[model samples]
Target: MLLRMPTSLSEAQRYLAEGAVPVGGATLVWALWQRDGFPEQAMSLRELPEATLIEREALGAAVLLHQVDDRVPDVLRRAASTVGTGAVRRTATVGGNIVGSTLRCLLPAALVLDARATVLDREGPYETDLAEVVAKRHLLLGLRWRDPVTSGYYKAPGEAGGPPPLVVATAVHTGSDGRHRLFVAVRDGYDVISETVPCHTGPDRALEALDDTGLGSLPAEAREAVRREVTGILGGPADR
Candidate 1:
């Protein structure tokens, strides 16, 4: 398999149009390679101008997970820190994490922060919600968001060295009316649920949103256990 390394956005797009899979950091690409399921060619975004750009309120897709630090928000930094071992964190790119099949550790924070992605596709450049960018498998260029007032994250581990069973990320935003509101994204395994509600509303809203998918598949006791643990992390039951 050939790796196409492009030095410009236009060159990257041209390669993408010709069916070369876009690669950043190559963590996911390596995983696919190990399984022998990766495509015959991949276009590396490392040399492109967008790869390492980090502004006050934005991060380029190619920014490594280890690079998410105090310069970024606490919630984002915390989530990125927990993703993998030191070596994997150093090699995983934000864009690859977002678009990967299994929801990586970074997405819940991105979702709760209301992040928007800047993408370049065969159709050309455009901006859209990060969720859509992931859903559509767009070639992510970078992500942008207004500064959140405050944020938090929670994870329920499965077993030693295994994937977490649940993760919740929260952000506090002040409305135009000047009241703080809470937004949350809950990841139960690979599925996710998000909601916006009054501040301190707790985990019920997001958990209920996951009913038909994440929570529904679990046994009754297990669901209750999730509710209890998430509630402890998020605070008292929903005020509403």
Candidate 2:
């Protein structure tokens, strides 16, 4: 838990950035070494500053979220198997995925929640929109997504031992506090941002929302909506 509070990417770059080397989770470190050689520093982010959700710019990185999303479901299983096999995903970092501008499984889920990454900087804690943060090479440790939002993830794998060609994500849910968030993600470099009226009360509201989205339309295709491939009877990708 080495706590590092870099005010901006420059600071992050200078502090952790070594030569032309990429830094994040151990995977990146080893990857660089695999291609080049050992790193000057084995930087640790476990004790890094907390993400301050200021201005909705706290959407850290795909690699970071990928490593932390522990929800049990077929979608998760599919995502875990998204790129490479178990050994690969195990070393992949959600932050690195996003930072490298590579398409990842978590993008769709993050987009749907209209999620924001909370940041904790020198001036205190603030929030940043995930879109803006990833716009450049910003160093992100963690994220804070608004709770109770309904969302889903989709992945298209490539080759048997590679990564998914693309991952589509959508989040739609009504918070207990009376707020609705609609998030959508497409491709590796682009994302769609939209807002929908509050349409849920919680997980229990699944039935009502599904009805509105077209329960009959569910299990139809992985187009854009809710598809529960994770043992979730509705619309979802194939359970891996």
Candidate 3:
């Protein structure tokens, strides 16, 4: 297999247009190649200096998971830390974690942050929401977000360190007019089954809003556990 390292986005796009699969960190690609053989061509984004940068409000797609541990917001940092062990974290890129994995820890936090991704297609670089880019299977160039007032993420992993069964992320941001905007995203395995509900009052009201969603359909014990975990992070009424 031919490996082409592109130093610029345009160069990468040209390779991609010719059907070269983009690779960052190679964690996911290597796994697939082990079973299915290498692709005809592989475009490596690692040589692009911009692809690994971690700016104040933007994270390059090739930025390693461990690179985000102390540099990003607490919620994002916490989520990044949960991804496998030291070796895996050191080699896994943010884009791979988001677009390659079926269920990712970083995505819930990205959802609450209202993150947008810059992607390259044959048309050129375009921006879209993270979810949209993932759904369209676009090549993510980078991720950007605005600073939030407060944010938190929680995930309940499956047994034997498997994929998480429940993941919840919440963020509170104040608009220009000083009104607060609250967002909550819930994901279960492959399902993004919950919607963001407005919490006009406070964290207590946020917990109350959960009942209006499919969260109420969960077993009583599981529902309560989720509530308590969210409450512990956001400081709501834990008993509720």
Best lDDT among the predictions, by candidate number:
3
Tell how far residue 59 is off in model 1, in angstroms. 1.3
Q: Which regions of candidate 1 deviate over 4 angstroms?
A: 34-40, 160-163, 200-240
Task: For model 3, give the RMSD to the true fold.
Answer: 3.6
Q: Write model 1 residue lDDT over 25-50, tens digit each, in one string.
A: 88767876778777888887777777
Error of 3 at 48 (Å): 2.1
Which model, 1 or 2, shows the larger TM-score?
Answer: 1
lDDT of 3 by residue, 1-240 (tens): 899988987888789889998777898789789899989998867777667778757888888898985466666877888887899999998888888877666887888777888888877788898768778777788888877767777777567556566777777666666776666666766666544555556557777777777776766755766577556655542111
Q: What CA RMSD would you report for each candidate? A: 4.9, 8.0, 3.6
User: Model 2, poorest ten-residue lDDT window?
Assistant: 51-60
Clashing pairs in 3: none
How far off is residue 78 in model 2, in Å? 5.6
TM-score quality measure for candidate 1:
0.79
- Cα deviation of 42, candidate 2, in Å: 4.8
Q: Rate the local accuracy (lDDT) of all candidates.
A: 0.74, 0.45, 0.75
Write candidate 2's Cα lDDT for 77-139 as tens digits. Answer: 334456555675765665665555445455455545555654333343456777766675455
